[model samples]
Target chain A: MIRFENAHIGYDHDLIEAIDFELPNSGIIGLFGKNGTGKSTLFKTIIGLQALRRGNIFIHHQNISEIPGKLLAKKVSYCPTQILSYGNLTVWDVVSNGRIPHLSWLGKLKTHDIELVENSLELMGISDIKQQLISECSDGQKQKAIIASALAQETSILLLDEPTAFLDYPSKQELLKQLSFISEAGKLIIVSSHDLDLFEELCDLKLLLSHHKIITSEDTDFNKYWDEFTTKGLAK
Target chain B: MTTGKLTYLLLGLLLLVLFILGIGLGSADIGFMEAIKSLFKSADSSPEAYIIQELRLPRSLVAILAGAGLAVSGLIMQTLFTNILAGPHILGVSSGASLFVALTILAGSTLGDMSLPFAAILGALTISSLILFASRMLSSGTILLIIGVMIASFCSACVSLLEYYADSSALRSFVIWTMGDFSAVGKTHLPTLAVFVMMSVAICFAFSKGLNALLMGESGAHALGFRVKSLRTWILFITAVLAGSITAYCGPIAFVGLAVPNLVRFIVKTANHQVMIPLVLLTGACFGLLCDIISRLPGDDRTLPVNVASALIGAPVVIIILLKYQKSIR
Candidate 1:
């Protein structure tokens, strides 16, 4: 489990504060917020990219701040929302990079590393397109490739920031379904999305970013936030 | 054969052929057999032997070193900026090196034979770090590119100021350097240039895996355990060393760094830096040797400047490759 204690997180100043929560080690977490809310910042803080303002974050009973980057990488994988154009990189090449921390300095992939890459590709159902350049992959396929790369890392905790932003409806559903399935494999998967319906239907837990605080609850309370989202939209 | 192996075989042959051509096809018109004999003989008193051993051999070595150095540096820059057009010269590194050379010339400061190159390296290092810090402040590649060009123009303006104050002799020397040549450094300097260039390439290969991870984007690389900021900084540092040393020796020879990696990428059709680095090195050396040979103009007593030859040769090849891979570039 990942536990946040009085977590105040942001880049410059605290965008959200008092984020006290314990995320179960194996479940699907839906992070939902308005455009300017601190969902991405929270994820960044947990993944050690952004500094926490005033708090302790513990991953698997070890303080996150004390863990080395490579060790931390082995435990948590982060997927950014924007996928930049990677010139000439095939799906296999991109996925293979996830084995970086696992490989030695020379980075000659071991047989097991290669097998993990293949397994991740198969898990993401992108084995057929493994040889295709990332630039040529469709938006949905590219998202899956990114997720496959994260999976290839074999981390226990996976954090994705707006993974479905540019994906179409079916693509979004497929990606979320994959995330839910991944959580079922005993990995903690946290995905930030605007898809309220999918979150209600697929996520085991939901964390709502509102008014500079994180409100956590089970999916039974998602309806409360849906009404809140629509009323806020109507008021605006 | 795979493209990689074929690229290796063809490049190796090209290097050999160009090495021979570089030695034999200069204005002296020595036979290939005579050049070979002269290369092995220590006491051949013939002017042909002297030229072959003293001038032509060092020039060939320097050409290969500078060419391969610039090409790999260009590859790293292209990867760092994620732009197909990025090169050693694009970020004003050459101009930065040139400005320092101008300062040393105009001031009449003497730092020994190695001082000028060291000064150039310092200049390149300073300017690269400035641009890197600017990258932290700005996110747009286009903005960073504009900043790099502006820095180049600024360095050129500084060079112009130094030129205005310089004596005619110093002015002439600076102008000659600007024109670019492979003949300036003699046998004395080749060992040092060879060592530095070799070390730079080694460092690049050591970081090739991390560099490959960088292609996935900075955050992605970071998540995969590569320190993106340090990686970028180290890349710039290595590029400065390679490019600065080349500029210090070869006077900022153009287009090899810009064009060679693009050409290699087109031929190989993969983004694996492990494969690309060695290929770029070999192809770059061959390309450089070829340019050096063409600059000699073989039969003509007067030869073209290497910069002009490189552009004349490299630019069109790059343009053709770009045209063919236009969609991929975007």
Candidate 2:
């Protein structure tokens, strides 16, 4: 199981702490907090993208930092918000890149690898746009293409940062439906977003960041959370 | 800019025609038949054959290689920095090579022909390190670009200072070197140059996937499980080797380093570096060869520098790009 024990992350002067947690085995774990509460920092930490300031994170009885970078990629695959700026790539090319972890430094693709990419495209309903460039797709199709990439990673856990930010009604619903299918395969999903209504609809458990630390939704001070969020325009 | 399959197919054909034309015309002007014969090492000993082997062939090859390398470097740099204007010459690296080269000539080092390219390579490495240092200190991409330009301006001032103090003969050498010449390339350096260019171009080809992973920006590549820093560093290294070495040997021929990739993008309408890069390579080679020919058209010692011709070709393209697809390309 993944565990964050007193882990903290800081950037030059700002610091965000992870008090403690034993991540649940298999369900969506929603992250919610005020703007400066370091919700994004915590998600980045779990993925090993941001360096920790103190304490350590462990995956399957081993410290994540100790694992080799390639091995670590295999263990924890992440799906951030759909990248807005990537140009020139098709849905297929972007999705197939998820196999980077399985490939050697030479990075050649085998037949099984092609099958995985195809399977993922079909699963995400992105097969219709498989040859279309990423920039050419609509919002929901882009997000599904992003999910196809994550599914291609074939990991036990998926970590997404604001999976539904800037999405419209039907687009957000389409993404939520995709996420539901994803979480059904005993896959553990962690999504951080301020789309409270949509987020609450999909996530099984919720996490909140406050007081420079992470805590469960049950332990969070709702009045204070909403006050900081409302005042800071974070929860809106 | 309309990239229907037909447009791309026509563009591909147009590029191929330009490449063959490039491989065909040169200083000694061999007939197509004799030139083709010379490639197989069985030409008859006419002046045509000697000219084909000694002058035209190597000159054409250098033009193609240098053009392709510079264009691909610009393409990769533009992608890596995510700035539309990030060309190979922007960071003062080319000027760096020109600087030490001017100094070497002023010193009358007698280091022979090879010393010039070597000195230029040294200058490129130094400037590249400076750019990397500036990047580390500066948070904003625009700031880093300006800082790099500031360094380039400083280097340019130094190049002018050397020109002012030098003897007439030395000054002429420095000026010719700066004008950039494919015709003057020594045969001895060609093999090493070819190998290095091919290897780095191959590296860029390999990184097409990684570069595409990067087209989404650094954070996006990270989420895709790439070591963004490692991949970016390698891209920089490859760009340097390709563009730096070409600038060192050929002087600062301009714009193919800046324009060809964008033209390829315009033609193909795909930013997939995999396809875009090879297109850049071919298109760059063809463009460079064409520019090299244009440099010779005035004749009678009125030959313009290749840089002047390229800037003519490039500036309009840049302006058009800015006016039209600037926002999306950026």
Candidate 3:
């Protein structure tokens, strides 16, 4: 379980709150927040890339800050908003790089490692284009390649920021379907996304970041609370 | 083999021919047939044999090492910055070394081989410290690059100042080194240069995964379990050594670093640093040797500096790379 306690994050002079949050035991959680709600910063903190002004982040009951680089990789994975710019790498190479945390500086993969990479490729449905250069891949395929790399990491939890931002309507829905399918296997999945219509159908939990309310069940009255919350904010 | 492997192999073979040409021909003009005979047995006793063994052979080896070192440095710079055009020169490490070298000469320090390389390395480390400081404190790669270039231009200005004040002898030596000449490398210096190149190349190759992780940018690499800060530190350290000594011995050779990694990526199409590292080494050696051949060809009474030759060649290749392959560099 990933847990955060009174995490106070600040950028330059401005401070985001000292808020506490925890991962639910199962399924997809939608981080529903407008731009500049500190969602991206929080993701960086959870991944142990950024230092916290207050509180601690615990992964699998162990503090994430204390883990080594390779070990951290074994436990957590993240997909950022910015696309990677590496020259001349094929789709196969990018996905296989997920195994780096498991390998040594001089490490090459064992057969099991190769199998896992193949599995990731197959799951992402990118096998036919595994040899295709990244420069040659389409937008959807490129998005899937990023997802495929996350899958190859085989972490218990996956964190993504705006995974569907550049994708088309069908691609967004397809990614939502994929995320839902992934979460069903008892993995903890969290994605910060903006597709409210797709989230309603596919998400198990909805978190309204700006308003500070979390809806933990599918049966939660999102419509009622959302209307009331927006009205209250306007009155202020 | 795939096209990538086949192209690298051909490049390797082409490098071998250039290597032979490097030993066979020079300003003295041994001529190919006689040079081969001299290799077998002092050329049936020619002054040519001593020149080849004592001068050209070591010089050629230095040329290879400098090329390979600069090439690998370019590879790491591109990976670290996540920009295709990024290289040691672009990032100002080379500039830092250039300034240090100019200062060393200006300070009345008549440097030996070891001291010259050592001073250059120290200078490069200083620049890396500045780049790292910006990368950590600012969280901006672009800012780091801009700062680096600013420092580099500052160094270039200093170099010009040094050029103006120096007497003819010092100025001549400085000018020759600046143009990246390998013809002056001595037999005694080859072993140390060789050891340095091999060890640094091994270290650079060892960081292949870290480099690949780096290409994905810092945050993504952090998630994949890489200590991104540490990895960047190591890569920068290795690049400094690879580039510094080459600059110390010869002068700052350009574009080979900027060109070789892109060239390898175009051929290999695998961003995995594992494959990219070895290919970069091979291709870098190939590039250096080829450039050396053009610089040292028989017609000129005084051989051209390798840098001048590489720039004439490298400028076109880089332009073509940018013009034709716009999407790949990204």
**Superposition error at A9 for model 1 (Å):** 0.8
Which runs in model 1 stand beyond 4 Å of their true positions? A218-226, A234-236, B43-46, B109-112, B321-330
DockQ of each: 0.60, 0.38, 0.63
Pairwise DockQ winner, candidates 1 and 2: 1
lDDT, candidate 3, A1-236, per-residue tens: 77777767646632456556677766787776666767787778778787777777788888877877677778778888755545676788778878878886685877888899998898778999998877788777877888888888888888888888788888876777778788888888888876666775677767665543343334357667655645665311
In terms of lDDT, the best-performing candidate is: 1
lDDT of candidate 1 at residue B247, scale 0 to 100: 89
Weakest 10 consecutive residues of candidate 3 chain B by summed lDDT: B105-114
Residue B260 error, candidate 1, Å = 0.8
Model 3: runs farther than 4 Å from truth?
A: A5-22, A211-225, A228-236, B1-5, B28-46, B128-151, B298-301, B328-330
At residue A206, candidate 1 shows an lDDT of 77
Judged by DockQ cut-offs, is candidate 3 incorrect, acceptable, medium or high? medium
Q: Order the candidate numbers by DockQ, best to worst.
A: 3, 1, 2
Give a tens-digit lDDT track for model 3, residues B139-250: 4555766787898898889899988998877877777778887766677777777877789999888877778777666788888877777778888888888888788877
Interface RMSD value for candidate 1, one decimal?
1.7
For DockQ, candidate 1 versus 3, the one ahead is: 3
Is candidate 1 or 2 superior in TM-score? 1
- Writing each residue's lDDT as its tens digit, candidate 1 over A1-236 gives 89988989887888898878789989988888888788877877776778899989999999989988889999999888866655577888888888888888877888999999999999888999998877787877878888898999999999988888778888777777788788889999998988776676788887888778777774466567657865776312
